[model samples]
Target chain A: AQSVTQPDIHITVSEGASLELRCNYSYGATPYLFWYVQSPGQGLQLLLKYFSGDTLVQGIKGFEAEFKRSQSSFNLRKPSVHWSDAAEYFCAVGGGGFGNEKLTFGTGTRLTIIP
Target chain B: EAGVAQSPRYKIIEKRQSVAFWCNPISGHATLYWYQQILGQGPKLLIQFQNNGVVDDSQLPKDRFSAERLKGVDSTLKIQPAKLEDSAVYLCASSRAGGQADTQYFGPGTRLTVL
Candidate 1:
């Protein structure tokens, strides 16, 4: 079974500061990873996804994540944090088979931007 | 393209009551999914439909939860005799197909509060 782990429950970063959200996954084979953002009272929105391509994948809102096989991590990073970036982020793992495209997500990390 | 759509943005019901959520996927989408997201936790897949057929529903509690996608475009998830623990956000997502690389688009989700 594939599982994702997000260590940080909540994080606060000053506006214009760099931010990184840690994500770890446990999967037997090459896993398809994804980053999703959810605002309060809103559904999730895809940030980016990693299949079998470049290690670094760029997403919307100037977010990027690097897939590190050695560490089994796909951490989300943003150079400059904006007040609008404050939201809950989730890490998910997929790709078990054809009928197993469903994703297993981590608990999520709530980000707060302080001006 | 328009994103997935879910009805009843918020619902409050007493314990043991019945509730249903409706979802309309993006046009031409062949895959639809229902997920349960508890507060402070990641979303968990409850059921998945591939063209009006069940592809995955192992996690759904059949005794209380049931879902169906008719005509392969719209879906509904119903919970009978809901429990207090069942109070969570029910999210509906849709994808182009059942491919591992297909990105899923989510709806605004229906927040369920069982009193």
Candidate 2:
């Protein structure tokens, strides 16, 4: 089974400060990792994805993530966060499981940005 | 391209009442998924369909929940005798189902409040 764990339930960061959200996954084989953001009353939007080649992947909204196989982590990072960046972020792992397109998601981390 | 679409963005129903939610995937998307997201939790897969065929439905509660994608384009999820625990956001997502890392686009989600 593929599962994701997000240790931080809530995080508060000041505007213009750097941010990092931790994510850990358990899967038997190589896993497909994804970062998604959800604002109030909106659906989730894909920020980035990591499949095979690169350990570091860039995503929309000036965000980036690095896949560390040794640690079984794919952490999302941003050089600076804006007030509008306040939202819930989720990490998901898919593939290499019972079903082809099934995804296992983490509990999510709610981000709060203050000026 | 337009993103996934869902109907009845908000619903308030009493316990033991029935409610249904609808979803329409992107034009060419072959895979559709229904997920239940409880407050402060991540979205959990309830069911999945691939071109009108069931791909995975391991987590769906068969006793109270039922879903169908009759023509493989539009889908519906229904809950009979709703419970207080059923109050959550029902998210619908779709993917092209092309490869290992296919990204799933999400709808705005229908927030159900069980009174």
- Mind giving the per-residue lDDT tens digits that candidate 2 earns over A1-115? 7899999999999999999999999999999999999999999999999988989999999999999999999999999999999999999998854446678899999999999
Residue B14, candidate 2: how far off, in angstroms?
0.9
| lDDT of candidate 1 over B8-103, digit per residue (tens) | 999999999999999999999999999999998999999999999999999999999999998899999999999999999999999998799899
Clashes of each: 0, 0
Query: How does model 2 score by TM-score?
Result: 0.97
Off by over 4 Å in 1: none
- List, residue by residue over A1-115, the lDDT tens digit for candidate 1: 8899999999999999999999999999999999999999888999999998799999999999999999999999999999999999999999769867989999999999999
Off by over 4 Å in 2: A97-99
In candidate 2 chain B, where is summed lDDT lowest over 10 consecutive residues?
A: B95-104
Q: Model 1 chain B — which ten-residue stretch has the worst lDDT?
A: B94-103
